[model samples]
Target: MKARNKRLILVGSGVALLVAAVALVLSAFQQNLVFFHTPSEVAAGKAPTGKTFRIGGMVEEGSIAREADGLTVRFAITDTAKIIPVTYRGTLPDLFKEGKGAVVQGRLEGGVFRATEVLAKHDENYMPPEAAHAVEQAQKAAQTVSQ
Candidate 1:
């Protein structure tokens, strides 16, 4: 092939490879992307099923329960307007407590959330932005209903 043709071919191949690399990166990112939802959103059927996601809200008071083996714990996460039952089979964080802000990552199955990981507030004043917004919205909704 002529020198010019060879250069053109090389440039075309490089462009094609770059495009392929970008597409692969995007596909991987999409597959690994996790979404956050509130209890109200989950209850409204807005959460993705059969895929991992995050649910943020306050751990409902009087909803924490432990099994006989002590490895499994069940609790309810609430946005004040709706609640979702979550089951976790691992040690909880020291800061985790009922009525405290939490973000649980897991999948919903059989009307319950099977948590793979649970995140608690880092400090006394810390609350996930999504959870805070959810609580605020729920409160506003409750006030609207009562008035």
Candidate 2:
């Protein structure tokens, strides 16, 4: 085989391998990706039905109910206009509290969210930007609907 022809074949093979590697990495990343949605989005049926995802909003007041088991707790997450019921069966973050902002990652089950992980704000007035934006948008939508 000619030397130039051999070099061309090697370069093409290297490019093909690089492309395959990048595709593999992207597919793996996509499988692990979890999207974030607000309570209003979940209530509107916009969230994935059974896939793992994240929901962020304010924990509703007077809606927290701890089960007999020390680790099980149910509460409502609200984005000002809508609420989603969430159940967590693990130790909650110390910052987790009603009327505070929280982000929970989990899947939806029978209209309720089963949270596998919970993230609460680090301090007072430190709401996550996405949660705050969602709440503001929900409130605006509610006002528009009322008018």
Candidate 3:
């Protein structure tokens, strides 16, 4: 084979290997990634079924329920468009309260979100961007429904 042909073959193999490496890395990252979703999206079946994800929204008022044990708490997340029930069995953050913005990371099962982690906004005026966006989206949806 000519020298130029040999060089081309080597370069082609390197490019193929690089592409494969990148694809493999991306696949692994995707599996570990927790995507953000709003209650409205979950209600619309846009959220994954079993895969873990982050959901951000306002904690529905008058929806928090504590189990007899006190550790297991259940509440509903709302984006104004829809509500998603969430259950968490752990000490909640001090900021966690009804009618506040929160982000929960967990999986959905049987229409209930089983949260492994929960984060609440710290102050009255402070809210995560994800939570803010979700709230805005939900408000828009609510307006559309009312129209």
- Best candidate, TM-score-wise? 1
Per-residue alpha-carbon lDDT of model 1 for 1-147, expressed as tens digits? 899999999999999999999999999999999999999999999999899999999999999999998889999999999999999999999999998999999999999999999999999889999899999999999999999
Per-residue lDDT over 1-147 for candidate 3, one digit per residue giving the tens place of the 0 to 100 score: 999999999999999999999999999998899999989889889999889999999999999999999799999998877899999999999999999999999999999999999999988988779878888977886788899
For model 3, what is the C-alpha lDDT against the true structure? 0.92
TM-score of 3: 0.80
Worst 10 residues of 1 by lDDT: 122-131
Candidate 2 residues 1-147, lDDT tens each?
Answer: 999999999999999999999999999999999999999889889999879999999999998899998999999999999989999999999999999999999999999999999999999999889999999999998999999
Model 2 misplaced regions, further than 4 Å: 144-147
By descending TM-score, how would the candidates be arranged?
A: 1, 2, 3
Selected candidate, larger TM-score, 1 vs 2: 1
Query: Model 3 residue 88 lDDT?
Result: 98
Instruction: Give the higher-lDDT candidate: 1 or 3.
Output: 1
TM-scores, all candidates, are 0.95, 0.89, 0.80
Ranking by lDDT: 1, 2, 3
Q: Which pairs of residues have clashing backbones in candidate 1?
A: none
Model 2: residue 69 alpha-carbon error in angstroms: 2.6
The per-residue C-alpha lDDT of model 1 at residue 122 equals 92
